[model samples]
Target chain A: MSAADAIAVAGVTKVFGSGNGQVAAVDDITVSIRKNEFFTLLGPSGCGKTTLLRLIAGFEFPTSGAIWLDGADVSDTPPFRRPINTVFQNYALFPHMTVEENIGFGLKMLNRPKAEIAERVAAMLKLVRMEALAGRRTNQISGGQQQRVALARALAPAPKVLLLDEPLSALDYKLRKEMQIELKRLQAETGITFIFVTHDQEEALTMSDRIAVMAAGRILQVGSPREVYDAPADRFVAGFIGESNLLPGTVERVSGGLASVTLSVGGRIEAVAPDGFSGGGPATVVLRPEHARLMPAAGAPEGAIAGTLATAVYFGTDTHYHVRLADGSDFTVREQNRPSVEARFHAGDAVAAVVEPRAARLLRERP
Target chain B: MARPFDVRRQRGFTVVAAFCFALLYLPIVVLVTYAFNAGESIANWEGVSLRWFVAAAGNAQVIDASIRSLQIATAAALIATTAATLAALATTRTAPYRGQAATFAALNLPLMVPEIVTAVALLIVFARIKMATGYTGLGYLIAAHTAFCIPFAYLPIRARLDGMDLNLERAAADLYATPVRAFRHVTLPLLWPGILAGFMLAFVISLDDVVITEFVKSGGQETLPTYMLGQLRRVITPEMNAISTAFLALSIVVVTVFFLVSRKRD
Candidate 1:
């Protein structure tokens, strides 16, 4: 355990129900969040990301482990006893209170002086840029304004940690984009630990300093957005973070921290192998859509996979090429639509797909 | 260019609705109209006059009974609503346990059984208490009304508590509010309208209760309804109609307020 960590979830498992009906909502997860880090838990529905956030927020107690906040074991404590606050999925603002009052609520609950409450509330209002709407009821404000108010209210308490549960899912697209930038700025300005939970990979990739990708109540990978995206730890992480083409292959050899794999689709490619060496077995090669290119078979690089160009569709910013590899599986490739990045190969042409040396990764298939 | 589904267009629909309204309001309408009759006879209206209203007001028994009714209603409504609020929070706020359904059924027992049966049961139970204590006061009547009005106070409050977002309570707790403080600051204010509506319902229910009051009350404890019953047995006059009209108006006013207060905003 590091002293710099703001929170540590040590082998926590939260189980719901009893006896035969039991199901673990958070299954044996142990992770540490650094102080002032914008940490995100990204997963699909029923992945227990929200449940883990609740465990950190002290709403749900772990079935078999402890939660440490600032060097204190707080798993047995109630939510009110902890110094953490949450921005709920629905905002959960007091409907009867005005925006100013909602923001001042946590301060008032802490029995801060009335003058201090007013000053802090004013500062928060300006921080979220809701000074003009201070007197308005929370229901009276627009959705985006309500989101800002939720942020201001959660941050006004200067909590040691803030837990956000899909706070932007209710907002429209434009507002969500705006709030993503606003949230990062707030986290930086406040310098408080923010543990956010969402299923949207792009949101997590864009706003998070580090992300824990979860599935089926188990965290699959934890790394920076780029680390988890460009060099995913395994099959699930690679598929979830972005578009990936997983091709079956056998590991040929491991040398110089890279493994060359012989593809079943009639080619061989080199990939930066994962940690730990001296292994030779069946492995899958991960090729990212944006990392590959299409060219005529005659001009292709050595050992490049030869394929037939099946379809090329323009997507404004990029063109998507669906080429059928030798085994007749679709080998998808995406190219940026810059002037020099025009699609030269059309459908029904003999083409070869070239993968950059760094773009491929070897995942050893579990026996 | 399709027609909307209108119930009126169906055969016998308008007839059935009109018949229902007519049956429900026809008696009250007849009584209200006769309350303004100038003559002493309730069956014949001589002309429009304020004589019956004035006579009813001037009668000392009517005034005494009216005052007693108001006092009992206020006390019963306040106590019943308080008890019902606590009961509602207890039942709905916590996780369900064994016997929770039975508790709910018991709370609403007075409404299910016939009023006469409840009155008779109370009569039997109170007879023993009275004989043992040798006490006869309005306390018994108030106690009976309170018991009967509890379910009246409970339904609206329980519905409101059910419809409320439970996350608001969690949010309050996350903001460092103690359980009591969360209820005081967040839960209570949102539940205020429901409490008010429940109180009004309990007030109206207790104000006009007859069978229980008849069985439970001691001597000189005649509320307006019981007093009217006594007058009906003695003589038939427009004064009774005036009192009934006033009672009907009071109920309508309270129920209207209850309806307005219980309207959900969100």
Candidate 2:
């Protein structure tokens, strides 16, 4: 554990049920979330992101692991004793309390002076810009406003770390977008380490300083949004983070975090060997549509892969060319529509797909 | 915007609903109306007066029974509600344990069992306890009523706990509130309507209990319902109707207050 790490989850595993019914909700996972950094646990439903967050919050006990908060082992500490707070997915604000009271509840629990609580609550209201409606009951407020109150309530305690469990999942699209930036601003202003759990890839990419993409109760990769999106760690991360054209290939050799792979269509391509890549086996090359472009097959570059154009889709600002390679695997190439360029090719035209250098990577496949 | 199969719009719906309403309320209406009869007999339609109400109020036996019923109901409602709240929290808050369903079934068994059967069972159990302890004060009735009213109270309290968002308490704990504090601030306030509803149900159940009181009571220990049952065997008078009307009004007031309080909370 590093001194700058706000939370260190070491081999944390949370299992539920017993006997024949036993299942690990959170498999053995080790991660270090930095202090003052907005870290996100991104995954689909039942992927154990929420369970992991709950473990760090002390709401759950890891079956056989230690959780360190600020260099102190707090694995056995109860939630109330931990210096962490959570903004629940449903905002779980006290329905009977006014917004001010809800925000002040933590301070009251901490036995802060009445005046100090009032002052802190007022500041929180102003931080969330809910001062005008501090006296309103939580149920009386709109969903967006309730979200703000939840944020304010969680922030009011000035906890060492704030855990947000898909807090934006309940908001409408426009409000969700707005809160994305709002949440980023709050994280920056507070300068507190925020551990956010979200299933929305776009939301995680937009707000997180670093993100841990999770699947099947394990962290697949932990990096900045750009790293995860640009160079995924495995097949699941590549397929889950964004759209990718997965072409079946075989790894000829691997060295220096790069893999030399021979495509099924009798062409050779270079791919970034993400973590979990095993040597000398069949693999799938992840090529983002934007990383490749289509050209006329006649007199095309020698390194370009040859294919037949299957379909072309217009998407206002870009056009997607779906190409069927000789191996029957489809590759999609996206190009921005420039006014100076002409219509490239229609459906069923022979085309050459050119992949940008160091833009594609093959990952180890589970047979 | 109309529904395709609105039950209220079905053929003969109004007639059927009215018939059911009459079947339920017409007898109560006649009883309340006759409570003001001037004549001694309840069978005849006499001039309207409050003579029976005054007579029932002045009668020492009726007064004693009324006070006894109120005491038992109040004590039982309070004890049952507290126990129900604890049981509700235990059942709903924790992870599902072995025998959880069995515990729920046992808690609600009184609601499923016939009242007379429970009365007889309680009579047998209490008879042994009374003989061994040599105690036959109001404690026996209160304890019996408390036992019978538990399920009446548990159902509403448990239903409320089920409907509540468990995350509210979790959020409290996350906010540094201890478990007890969480219950006080988050769970209890949200559960007020359910608690009040449970208390009312238990109170009403205990207040009018006749079979259990009749089966278990020692000499000179008559509740209002047992006293009324005893009166029915000898003679028929409008005083019974007067007492029933008063009891009905009190119940209506309790229910109305509950409704208003719950509505205002919302």
Candidate 3:
């Protein structure tokens, strides 16, 4: 690892209960995060992403393995002594304290001088644009303001790593989007590592430098948003990262990096296999919705699968056509709504679905 | 807070509520008003005077008893409230423990049992201790009071503890505070009002207790209530009524203050 590696977890495991009741909440997992990176854990609820974050934060102890922060083993350290902070899901502002006081509590715990605490709190409040509401009781503020206060309080302490557990999940749509950009800007300004947890894939893709996509208490893939979206490693990741049509199939032929597979439904398709898939075997092909082209029967080309448009959804920027192919496979294609005749597609019309061979991914079928 | 004139139903409710209030307050009101009676008779109406108040003030035994009661009740409330706070914290904050309900029921056993039973059980235990070490300390009364008052203090505090948001403490820990620091800074401040109310309730309960105090107290260790009870056996005096009236007023004041404090928090 380089000097820029801020947090490293190796073979971490967490089990709840004992003996007959034992259930593993987090299976053995390993990850490394670089300094000043806004990394996100993207998974559905109950996927152990939050558990992994808590283990890193020292809020929950790992049942096995080690966690390192800034090259020091901090697995056994308590939360307070660790150079990490978190913004809780509910924003957890101290109801008894004013906004200024709530933001100043961590500094107070450091036993900083009163004047210094005041100065730092003032700067933090101004950064969050909450200086005007600093004197108000925390419960008296609006949810968005409280959210800012929670962020300000966490950031004011100058932690090396900040964990945000679904911080924007409680906010309304507009505020959540606004906070996402604000958080990105704040991370840019402070140059601190942020490990945010969320189930929203779009939010993760939009705000994070890298993302660890998790499911069933295990990490499925870790990569940049574009990398994960365009080149998912497995069916779970492909199905998760973006909308995709997965066609389970058996591998019939394999070349250097490409594979021609016979789908389960009696259709031959080509896919780009991940490295190290050697030969003939049962496999699955994944295709992104936008990768497939929908053309009317008159303009259709050879090698195109025939289908009828089941539904056409108009989404301002793009129109998605859901086509049910001859093999009974439902495929969706998103066409940009440019001012052209080709942009118009209607449900119940016969069309041809064409996807370039390289646009699809092939994965070995799981038991 | 006003009801725009409901003729019949409102009057009926008003009369019924007024009757209940009268039933609650009549004795105490009469006692306070006539505590200044100039005559010595207990049953006759007489002009008021400050004689009994003066007498009550000058009596060394009554003053000593009052001081002792205050000390014991304060100690008991402090001890009980502190223990109850810890119990509340463990049950609310930590990961759920097995048989938590059983633990809660056991802690709350004292409230369900009769006060006489607790008084006798304490007396027997104290007797054994005294026989073993020959110490007739008043510490036993404080201990008994603390044990009996635990349930009264625990219930309200535990309710507040349950209602308190755990997210605040998580936020504190996330902000790099140790668990103890989070409890001190975040949990305690949010829980203070409930703690105060619980303490005050335990204090009042300990002070007004007569049966338990009579059973556990040794000869010559007279609390104010016990002293008044002793007087009641021989002759009923308006002077006893005056002391009772004072105790009643104190209870009302503490309860009212508790309500105001909790309301202001809301």
C-alpha TM-score for every candidate: 0.94, 0.94, 0.91
- For candidate 2, the lDDT comes to 0.91
Cα lDDT, all candidates: 0.91, 0.91, 0.86
The candidate, 1 or 2, that scores higher on DockQ is 2
On the 0 to 100 scale, the lDDT of residue A214 in model 3 is 94
Query: Could you give candidate 3's per-residue lDDT for residues A35-61 as a string of tens digits?
Result: 999999999999999899889888799
lDDT of 1 by residue, A46-109 (tens): 9999999999988889999899999999999999989999999999989889999999999988
- Any runs in candidate 1 off by more than 4 Å, and if so which? A339-343, A364-367, B10-19, B255-266
Q: List clash counts for every candidate, in order.
A: 0, 0, 1
Off by over 4 Å in 3: A250-252, A262-268, A327-329, A338-346, A364-367, B1-19, B36-44, B47-51, B58-61, B257-266
C-alpha DockQ of every model: 0.72, 0.84, 0.63
As a whole number from 0 to 100, the lDDT of residue A217 in candidate 1 is 90
Query: What local lDDT does model 1 show for residue A170?
Result: 98
* TM-scores computed on chain B for all candidates: 0.93, 0.95, 0.91
- What does candidate 3's lDDT look like per residue over B115-144, in tens digits? 889788888888898889987778878988
True contacts kept of each: 0.84, 0.96, 0.80
lDDT per residue for candidate 2 within A1-367, as digits (tens), equals: 9999999999999999889988899999999999999999999999999999999998889998899999999999999999998999999988888999999999999999999999999999999999999999887899999999999999998999999999999999999999999999999999999999999999999899999999989999999999999978778998899889887778889888788888888567788886655568787888999998788999778768889999899888999888888978788899999886766899889899888888997765555
Lowest lDDT sum, 10 consecutive residues, model 3 chain B, at B3-12
